[model samples]
Target: MAGTVNRVILVGRLGKDPEIKYTPSGMALATFSLATDESRKDSEGNRQQITEWHNIVLWGKQAEIAGEFLRKGKLIYVEGRLQTRSWDDAQSGEKRYRTEVQGNRFVMLGSRAEQGESPESPRASTAQPTRTSPDQPLEEEEDLPF
Candidate 1:
């Protein structure tokens, strides 16, 4: 192909509450850990599950929404690009590399058991619609730059 792609899409549960931060420029940045699992039957005919953890980052207005609506163990679908950062620790003088998913869009999958929230609760407004896929027509999405 003449072009390239750096996209990543994941559906998983949050490992912990998201960490929200603000840059000196006043932009919001939210970071969180997500867990994805795989299940299979072992040779002995027993079920086995494997979980993988991922670091996710959301910036600007998206980060703000993630902070407000997402919580620990909440399932979410995220679409983003993979980014790797390498730096040297100031005190340890050791180089480190980290990979993170830089989210462009997100959708809350809702709490599995709804946290005992009633169907008519006011907090239901916090629920949001799912994200758009690449196959969606550009005209139908919010007017945000890609």
Candidate 2:
């Protein structure tokens, strides 16, 4: 293919509450860890399970929403691209590189009740409406038929 694509999608439970921060320019940034699991029968027929941890990042409005609604152990669906960054470790003075999912959009996977949220509220839907990328226009609820 002439063009290249960098994308990632993950469905997992949050390992902890999102950590929100701001840039010197005041841009919002949210970082969190997600844990995904897989189970299978080993050669000996014993059930085995494996868990993978992913670093997730979100920006702007998406970051704001994550700080407000996401909590440890909550299941979420994230869609975005993979990004790697390197920085010098303060104590060791050694360079360290980390890869993170730069999420442009996400959907909460479980019901409000399952998340310990109020069921009678208008935001009681299992999944939050899809969030657009920073460059894309955000659509109001009235614009959606559902």
Instruction: For each candidate in the order shown, give its overall lDDT on alpha carbons.
Output: 0.75, 0.79
Q: How many backbone clashes does candidate 2 have?
A: 0
- Per-residue lDDT tens digits of candidate 1, residues 58-87? 877777777877789887878777879999
Q: Supply the TM-score for candidate 2.
A: 0.79
Looking at candidate 2, what is the lDDT of residue 84?
89
- Poorest lDDT segment (10 consecutive residues) of candidate 2: 121-130
Write down the lDDT that model 1 would get: 0.75
Runs in model 2 deviating more than 4 A are 120-146
Q: What lDDT does model 2 reach?
A: 0.79
